[model samples]
Target: MTSIKIDRSACQGYGNCVLALASVFDVDGEGLVVLRRDTVEPGELDGLRRAAYDCPTDSITFVA
Candidate 1:
C-alpha cells in the first residue's frame, strides 16, 4: 500500500488535490483538503501522485 501525507500548514485549500484524486482526497465544507484514505491501492497511486504534483504548495507527500 502507498501512504499519503499532507502538510496542513502548507496547504492552501486550493482543492487541486481533491480534483485530481477525488477517491483519495476531499475538500471539506471549509474548502480544506482532507485525506479520505491513508493507504492507497496500487491502482490509485498514479492518481495520488498526480494530485501531489498538482499541489501548488507541495504539501503532499507519498510514502511507498
Candidate 2:
C-alpha cells in the first residue's frame, strides 16, 4: 500500500492539507497537522495528492 509521510519540523500547520483531504489529514488542538492514516486507498489517491500539494510548508510526501 502507498503511504504518506509528514515532516513535523517543516509543517507550518496552515491546515491546507486538512482542508484538501479531511480523511487523511487533520489539525490537532494545538494547531498541528495530524495524519489520520498513512496508507492510501486507490480511490483516494487524488485527495491524497491534493493534500500533499496543498501543504503550505510542503511537509507532506508519499512513500509508495
Candidate 3:
C-alpha cells in the first residue's frame, strides 16, 4: 500500500488534484485542498501520480 501527503500551507486550491483524482482529493468551502483519504490503492497510483504532477504548488506527494 502507498501513502499520500499534502502541504496545506502550500496548497493554492487550484483543484488540479481533484480533477485528476477526485476520490482522493477534494476542495473545501475555504477553497483549500483536502484529502479524502491518506492511503492509496495500488490501482490508484496512476491517478495519484497524475494529481501530484498536476498540482501547480506541488502540494500533493506520495510514498510508495
Candidate 4:
C-alpha cells in the first residue's frame, strides 16, 4: 500500500496538487492543502506522484 502525506507547514496553497488530483487533494477555505485520504489506490499512484512533484512547496510526500 502507498501512503500520502502533506506537510501543512510547508504548503503554500498553490493548488497544483489539487489540480493534479482533486479526488485525493483539495484546498480548504483558507486555501491550504487538505488531504482527502492517506492511502493511495493502485491506479491513483501515478497521478498522486505527479501531484506531489507539482507542489511548489514540496509539501507532498509518499511512502510506497
Off by over 4 Å in 2: none
Top candidate when judged by TM-score against the true structure: 3
* Segments of candidate 1 deviating more than 4 angstroms: none
Deviating ranges (above 4 Å) for candidate 3: none
Q: Is candidate 1 or candidate 4 better by lDDT?
A: 4
Full-model lDDT, candidate 2: 0.86
lDDT of 3 by residue, 1-64 (tens): 9999999999988999999999999999989999999988999999999999999999988999
- For 1-64, candidate 1 gives per-residue lDDT tens digits of 9988888888889999988889989877877778888879999988888999899999899998
TM accuracy, model 4: 0.95
Candidate-wise lDDT, in order:
0.88, 0.86, 0.93, 0.92
The C-alpha local distance difference test score for the whole of candidate 3 amounts to 0.93
Per-model TM-score versus the true fold: 0.91, 0.89, 0.96, 0.95
User: Looking at candidate 2, what is the lDDT of residue 58?
Assistant: 89
